[model samples]
Target: MSKQHEKLRMMLTAALFAAIIGIMAQVTIPLPLVPITGQTLAVGLAATILGSRYGALSAIIYMLLGAVGIPVFSGMSAGMGVIFGPTGGYIVSFIFSAFITGLYIEKTSATVTQAFIANAIGMLINLTFGTVWLKVMADLSWAEAFVGGFTPFIIGGILKAFLAAWIGILARKRLQSARLLPSSTKLSA
Candidate 1:
């Protein structure tokens, strides 16, 4: 493909991925403060597939849409205030999670198992930021914060990570077959 065509394809793909992530957020199984949603899985998958720049741009696009009052967040909530709310930290963490995961996946060599591990680390980053924000907002101790905001999501996160990694592997293979990715960009785990 031409350079312009490739750039356009990447942009459109990023936007589509952001939209998918937003949709996944709405298919939530509510907990207490934080809901169990497939958004993290989508985020990880986008990162793994799109690379760091595009992945982070996709997340930023999602956040911007939500900030503009798009009903894209969990429970269909949106706007700047919602982002600054108790769960805001988690939303913000998506940017870093996507960026870090993409960076690692792009730079390091990793198998499916290693990719899953990277996904887990990314989720932990989200939990850490989210738990801290929850503590401040809820005025709870660390233990309380963890129980309320992080613990309940552990199983779901693990499941999502595994799924994301698996999907990533599949997508990578397909891309390789299609010659979408240059061999020089390959990473080994």
Candidate 2:
């Protein structure tokens, strides 16, 4: 594809991923404070497949949509209130998580294991930021925050990370074969 065409393809890919994230956010398991959601998995996949810049852009788009009162956050909730609420930290951390995951994939040879580790690290980042935010926002003790924000999500986070890595690698290959992926990054199978 020509350079212009490739750029358009990338833009579209990023937007599509952002929309995917929005759609996935609706799939949530209601819990106290931070609900279990598919947002993490979507963020991980977008980052691993789109690379750093596009991945971060995708997450930013998602955040902006939610910020603008779009029903993109969990439980069809949106607006600045949700973001500033106890769970807001996790939403904000999605951008960093995407960038981190994509950076790891692009900087090194993208592999399933590497993708998993990168996403796992991103999850930890989210958890730490979210836990601290929850503590301050809810005026809870460390142990209380841990239980409310971190403990319940640990196993689910690991599973989501693994799924993101496995499916992201597989999807990357398929996209490359279909020439749907931009030819800029080195994501050959």
For every model shown, what is its TM-score relative to the native structure? 0.91, 0.94
Q: Mind giving the per-residue lDDT tens digits that candidate 2 earns over 125-161? A: 8898889989988889999999999989989999999
Local accuracy of candidate 1 as per-residue lDDT tens digits, 32-136: 677888889999888777767777788999999999999899988899988888888898999999888877777775457767877898899888898999888
lDDT top scorer: 2
**Which numbered prediction scores highest in TM-score against the true structure?**
2
Q: RMSD per prediction, one decimal?
A: 2.7, 2.3
- Please report the TM-score between candidate 2 and the true structure: 0.94
Off by over 4 Å in 2: 183-189
